[model samples]
Structure formats: structure tokens, C-alpha cells
Target: MLSNQSEVPSLGPIQREQAWDQLQKNEFDMVVIGGGVVGAGTALDAATRGLKVALVEARDYASGTSSRSSKMFHGGLRYLEQFEFGLVREALHERELSLTRLAPHLVKPLRFLFPITHHLWERPYIAAGIFLYDRMGGAKSVPAQKHYTRAGALRLAPGLKRDSLVGGIQYYDTVVDDARHTMTVARTAAHYGAVVRTSTQVVGFLREADRVSGVRVRDVEDGRTAEVRAQVVVNATGVWTDEIQALSRVRGRFRVRSSKGVHIVVPRDRIVSDAAIILRTEKSVLFVIPWGSHWIIGTTDTDWNLDLGHPAATKADIDYILGHVNTVLVTPLTHEDIEGVYAGLRPLLAGESDETSKLSREHAVARVAPGLVAIAGGKYTTYRVMGQDAVDLAVDDIATRVASSVTERVPLVGADGYFALVNQTVSLGEQYGLHSYRIRHLLDRYGSLIGDVLSFADGTPELLAPITDAPSYLQVEAVYAAAAEGALHLDDILARRTRIAIEYAHRGVNCAEQVAALVAPILGWDAATADREVANYCARVAAEIESQQQPDDEAADALRAAAPESRPELLEPVPVSTPVQT
Candidate 1:
């Protein structure tokens, strides 16, 4: 048994073997494709149930739509309008589980203020809606909805226009670092003996007559290829579900349409609100979420048929969000206030309607072919339920009697002693010679894992210094990303492992060199490789910034697509030499 967090546990060489070895010996219960939230959860669900599972992703974990979501873990309040009680309840239960039992470190309760414009009718209508919302599944995890008059609401949100609301109702929901949560789920799956590998692409399906016997995987990092055989294969590829299904030569029961949602991040000082704000828009809902040190305002839902790899936010999208949000802001937010802009695609299941906004967020699972099960089209909140259902479908195909999913009761790796650690924040702060507020920040991000991070700082005093440009984050965290997390490239460190890419004014361009210099040794990168990585990351940032300036999605996608691919020198052998730290 692994005794310490630093001790790298053995998951068998085959789990990390080349594609040839995988093809040579392929005997598994299930092979799950995709490493998004749903896919990662599916792997954990299957593995915990005594199934020998292998999970593969073409890129980094949560590299697709999962990482680029609104990053909330709440029951869809809009779904209540659709009268989807079951979806809301299941999502709420999962949210509670995430916050209280599993991944408490990554998921925390966030309060939202729903502003009411009309005096009586709107107030009661919203109050009753929120009342039913509070009764859903995880209402007790946080404080119940509170009624506030216009004066009270204005006091809480001083940045709001006085006339925007007659009253307001504040309610609770969970928010998460969605990408990190997805990664932790994959790591948790690995901890439970699931063979999980990122940068591995599912090239094709291995068909034995009418049934899919296995998958042909290509190592996108290197140019190697292999085939992994399993009793069942599940497709949880999110937006890429249709492409995966086409490989098997089968018509899907349902199609997934991509809807692009864009968010703009501005400094918290710009919108002085203690709680997040939700307002109605002509097309859909607009949320001004309170992110750390910044507020995330967004989401324009429109059909996107452009590039799927990196959805670009057009000038029009930004203008729409800013225009709608500016309607209520006392100090209007313009393009200048935006520190970062991101666009993500939501895979909504196709319906008779052409309107992408009205498409179903509910997931669908179908046996496209014998031994092949595909799950697609779900909101991030209901990923666990989608995972459970996928695993249930795959279970029947297996010859052996598999155990039931125990994921509901299982706390994620960092969650076991989270509450106690949080309670001891004062003591921990004193122990580490840190302020209680800083300790609270660390605990919320890492939970008991904070101790392990602090241990590194205990020895290397230099690691405790905050990053040169981004003072909100410490330098040691970047080092930790290389040492602990499988951060292979500079993009992986800044973009996914940390929010420096979106959180910074320069979008991590200014801090890229320093971060690369610090992490180069840990990653065994030569000076040249380190420089290349930093350059690639800067180019990526430049591309995104340039893309957002375009007037339309088509033009924006072209501009963004022109950016250098993050994958540099794919065939370049892994270097053995390390860069000398300056």
C-alpha cells in the first residue's frame, strides 16, 4: 500500500506502455474513450466496481468543452422551467456529494443573487421558484434562499444599477474548478487501478465481424499506435461523439449539436458584488460569477458550426455579453475591463428545433453497435449520473457479474480529512507561518494536500515567494504542477493546471518565461525545449487575443486556428538533460 503522498504508486508498466505492447496484450473488461468529466467519472465508476478499466484521451484531461464551462456545480435552474425535476434532483445530489463528501477541496458552495425587477409578481414568482429549487437535493449543504429588498440587494451589490431590481433572492449552489475536478476524478480513477493515459488518441475501432472488440489508439505525443481490447467500449467523447461513432460505421440514435458559450473575466474590483449575479437575457441566461480576484460574466448560447478544436469568441459575442451585463452595472463594463475571454462548446442532444439554445442538456446513451456504447449530450452538473448510466449499459455486455458502482459513497483523494483541516485553519496557518486567509485559500484548493505543498516550501524557502507577475499564485505551485501533476508542457502548466492563462492581464505571457525556467528541471527539459514551450504558450495566447478581436465566429476561428499548435516537435525524443535554473 502507498504510505505517503510523494510515493509514486505502481499501476503496472502495461498501463503506461507503448501502443505496440498494448496491442500485443489486450485483455480488459472495459475501454473508455474520452477523459472529460463524464468519461473520467465513468472510468472511476467502472473500476471501483472491480472491472479492469483503461481510459484514453486524445489530448490533456478536460482539454475540450469540460475545461471551458461556466464552472458551476449546481442543479440547472433553467431545467426547472422545462420541468425536468429528475435531472435537477440528481444534479443537486451529485453537487452535494462533490461539496460535502467528494472533492470538497475543489468544489465549494457559492451564493447567487437573482435580481427581481417587478415589485410583487416577479418577487413571488422568483421566490417560489427558488423555494422549490432549495428543496431539490443538496439545499441543506448550504444556507437556504434569503429574501432581500431593493435596498438590501443594492447594499450587497453596490455595482448594480438602482433600477435593475426591485428586490432580490440569494440562493446557494456549488462551484468548482471544473478542469481540475475532472483531472482529480481521473487521478482518483488511477488511484483505484484504472489505466488512465492522456495524449492518447482513439484512432479507430477494432471490429470483429459485427461487434467492436477493441480500439486502435494512437499516441498523439509520439507517432506510435496500438490496439486495446476489452469486452466493452464506451464513447464519452462529448462534442466529438459523432466523429467517434462514424469510425464504427454506425448511425447514432441521436446527434449532438455544438453550441458556443463565451465568458469574459474582469477584475473583481470592477463589479463589487459579494455574491454572484444571474440575470435574464433575450436569448438565454447571463451570469456574473465571482471568481477568485475576478468576476466571470458570460454566456451567449448560439449554434456553432466552426472549428471544434478551439472555439473562438467573436467580437459580436463579447459585445452581446457586455451589452446585456452593462444594462444592470452601475459602472458599465467594456472590452477594456476584460482580462480574459474564452469560448466553449456545449454538446446538446439534437431535437426537432433548429435553435441550439433550446436543445436538451439531458444526456443520451445508446448501443450504436454490438459491444460499443456511446454516451453524449449532458450538462457538466449531471456528469456523474451520465457516467453511472454508461457503466450500467456496458455492464450487461461483460460476461462476469460486476459489482455495483460505489462512487457515490467514495470521497475523492483530497476529501477524506478536508473539513477537519478546514476547522484547524488557524492552527495550520500558525504552523506554516502563513496568514489564516492564505491558509483558507490553500485549503479550499488542496484540502489535506496543503500540508504536502507546505512541506516543499519548508525546505525550499524560495518556493514560498509569490509568482513575479501573478501575485495571487505562488511560485511553488508552478513547481508542484511539474513535480506532482503530469504537466508535460507550458500550456498544461498555465492553461489547465493553473488559471494563469485566463486570470492574468497578459494571459500568462509575461510570467511564461519564469514559470518555464522554474519547472524545466522537474520536467527534464533542455534550455532550448524550455524556450520553445514558452514561445508556444505565448503564441497560443497571442492567437486567442487576436481571435477575440474578430467580428464573427468564422473570422475568429480562422484567426485562432492560424495560431501555432501547442504540440511542438511531436516526434522529438524526450530529452534526458535538465535546464540549469537561473
Candidate 2:
């Protein structure tokens, strides 16, 4: 939070209306489309540099690939196999910077053990890569990698099969709540005077002769059209990059390919391991991440041409992950063990290779048209670099009189005074009549901004109580999601704001009605409207679960698309425009 924090710049109903009013009438130096990590980072970068900006998102922030990521802030160890040393080094530097300064509260160092089956040559080969990773990150990165024997590795990870490996290596990386981090970034941008609005979709580009000027955006919350004027427009949509480019009707400089990855969450007791594991599969790498009270086992990289918003995971995909991990686990996990499953798409830069895994994770910035700049293809670790690069190109096109990228010096919303807040957790817990552990959870999620969240439950003591079905989160979280955060739909609250969807066994269906009732009054929803929201969210969850049981991608996609959409206006028609061919 800032030194003179005023409720961390609330993004409630009042703020959204004001933002849209201003966006329709005023002209900004730059307007960024897509509220993912890169887009939010870009908005912050531009706002800090004294440029007037507006950030618009069709869905919630981090609703796409950002929220459904593997949640590791790594330098892509496997990239070294491709001999892309420059990319690895750049990502490593950014990873270290984020952990130390930019988002210290959100990103925390995590240890991962890499088991080696063949002792003689395999250790040396992996050791060389670890050495380069540490060297590339300077002294600011995570602790240097360590070599471990079979006995030491077994002590660290008792769940592993005895014959699975002869030795292991432990390395450090950072982990975070991806949705929370992205939302905080957007809030930070709003605090710095950038207009931020969600559920605003860009229908087409506003052009003056051959030069692009702004965008024609549709307000999904209310059926209305508005032209947001800006000197330069930046397209930062990740998986929707090519789709946004085609809207401009300009000759695209590059192409974007979507790759699907799925993760399944199970109980923490399912895998009795102290450290996370990185298993090398024949096709790619599989990560067993240690999430709170649960384990996240994931990620299959395959080409996906299905729905971008609702990427479905097939039965085969789940079977593949379970089968591979079972080879190394003493007690293998089954489909019944899964508490939640999520699928996301990666926007890789398309080129000669048809394989999505072979596509480049490195992003490119190009001036597709006169005043339009597009950025696509980058991993979560390197988003800040991508944001800086995107802004640099946009400013060049606009020729705006602004300072250089100072985002490297700007900390996120909760980064300021976070350590001091941690020290006062016990005092705060006593003041609120709650356990220190509960206060610690609030501090980690909200940092110094915990005051804003706690203040909402001050008069209403019942609001501080833990939810009935999902005890991990407090009831006040649901209220705060609507009263402060711009969560208009129940799905937004369950899936993104609090992460109850993936953390709970019922996948948020068990608590849907309760959450809807808690947030209804704040969002001005009547009994019937609240019931509709709950019903819609329940339908979505049921469809997703059924989709996961399907045999293949086609079957899964068909089943998932049959569910009711929370934001039906998103599927409504807009002022159509000609899309440039590939």
C-alpha cells in the first residue's frame, strides 16, 4: 500500500461507473487492452511514467491463462536444453527482482527436488544447468542448488517409490497466488491514477485514415457502446493476441499459437513430501507443487484449437499425468483423489514448428499499424520485462513526452511495509479476537492493506466467521470481493478472488448459495438475481467436471460449452469488423 493509503483505491460499483464516464469523454496517452499480468504491468509502468492510461478487460483480471498457471516463478530450466541462454538469464534476473522488491508479499521462495534415476552422468548434466541458473541470476536470486544422496532425498520426499531414483537435487524458485497478484497489480495501477475497468470488451479499433487512435469498447455489465480515445493503444491480450490483432485489419507481423495445460489438485496428505518435485516426462516436465492444505500436480503441453475462455481437460490428459506420476509415487493418486481440475492456454509465438511446445515463450513487440502496438508470447516470470517493452514501443509510436520505464523502482500495492505488518500480526490478532494464524493469513493475502479488509467486518462480527463448507476462507472475503474488488459475478468471487473453486473438494458448488447471499446486498442483487448467479455458477462447475470425464479434447469441449455463461453479454454481438487473415 502507499504511504497515504485511502482504502487502496476501491474498485467498487462507484469507481467503475466513474471510470467508464471518464474513459468515454477524456483522451489518454495510452489505453491497454487485456488485464492479465502483462497488461496490468504495462498499465502500472505507463501510469508511473506520468502517462494518462486506461486498462480495460473483457473478463476479470487474470481470468485467462494467468490464473490457471503452474504458479512457479522460475527461469524455465528446460529452456537450457534448447540452448536459449539469453532468455533464461533475462527471466532469472526478473524472477529475482520480483522476489526481492517488486512483489515480496506475493512471491515467496519454494524448494523443488529433482530426482535423478541414473547417478553417474545425469547428476553432472543437471548440475551444469543449475550452475548456469545461479550464475545468470547474480547474488540476488534464490539459494544455490544442492546435491542430495538417495537417503537424503528419501528423507525429504518419503512418498517417492524406492526404486524411482538413485539421488536427487534441490533447487529454489518462487511461488504465488497468480490471480491475487494480477488483481493487486491492477489495483496498484488504479492507485497510481490509471482508469481500470473490468467487463469492458474491445469490439474494434478506432482509426483515422491509416493511423489507429483508440478502440470501440462494449460494456458487458450494461449494454452500451463507447469510444475510448487514446494516443496509443496497446494490445496485451495473451491467448487472445491474434484475435485482437485481426480486429485491426492490419497486416500482422507475427502469429500466436495456443497451447493447453491442465492441473489437478488433491489433498496434502495424498503426497507426504516436504519439498515439491519436478519429474521429467518423455514429452515434457511435470511439477508436483505444494499448495496449502493440498498438492497441485500438473501440466501437459499440447496444441489446443478449442475455446480460449473455457479450455477443457480430457480424461486422457488426466490419465497421462496420473500414469506418469504413479511410476514414481509409492501410493499413486487416482481420479477420485482429485479435489479440483483446471485448464489454461499458453500464447506461444507461432513459427515453422507445428508443435506448441517447440514454439517460443519469448515475446515480441511490433507496431502493426500507425498508433497500435501489440505484444504477445511470454511466461509469467518475464511479464514485467514484457510490460516495459510494450510501453516503450507504444510511447515511441505516440511520441508522448514521458519518462523512461520506472516500474523497476515501483513496488506493487502490498509490497510497501509488508515486513512491518508481519511483525504486528499478533497485536492485530488480539485486537480482532482471532487466532494469530488467522491474522497471519489475512496479512499474507492483503499485506498492509489488511486494514481495509478487516474494517469491513468490524461492526458485523459474524462476517469474520469462516465459511461453512470452505473453512479456509472467511465470510468477509466474499463481501470484500464485491464491496472493494470489482467482482460482479459469483464465479469471479469463487474462481479468482478467493480461489475456493480449486481449493475445495466440491469445487465451490457447496458454498455457492452462501457466497451469493453474502455478496448480494453489496452488489444490489435481489433474491431472484442472487439465485440466478448461484445457479449459473453451479452449472458451470458441473459442466467442467463432466468435461474432465470425457475421453478426448473434442468431447470435453462440447460438454463444457453447453454450460450457462456467467456473463452472457460477452457472447452478444458487437459492431463487427473485418479480421485480417493469417
lDDT of 2 by residue, 448-473 (tens): 77888878898899999998999999
TM-score of model 1 relative to the true fold? Answer: 0.94
- Candidate with maximal lDDT: 2
Return the clash pairs for model 1, or none: none
Q: Assess every candidate by TM-score.
A: 0.94, 0.97
What tens digits encode model 1's per-residue C-alpha lDDT throughout 1-582?
Answer: 224434333222234553245444858899999999999999989988888888888877888898899989989887788788888888888888888788889988898999998966888887877888888864777998898999999999999999999989999987798887887788778777777877778877787877888888887766777889999999998888777777666666778889999999999999989999999987789988989999988899999877777899989999999999999999999889999988999998987479998888888998777889999987797787888899999987899998887898877766778889889999998887778888888877767677766776777878877889987777888887666555667787787878888898999999999999988887677999888888888888888998888899889999888777665322322121323111
Q: How far off is model 2, as Cα RMSD?
A: 1.8
| Local error of candidate 2 at residue 151 (angstroms) | 0.7
Where does model 2 exceed 4 Å of error? Answer: 1-3, 138-141, 572-582
Whole-model lDDT, candidate 2? 0.88
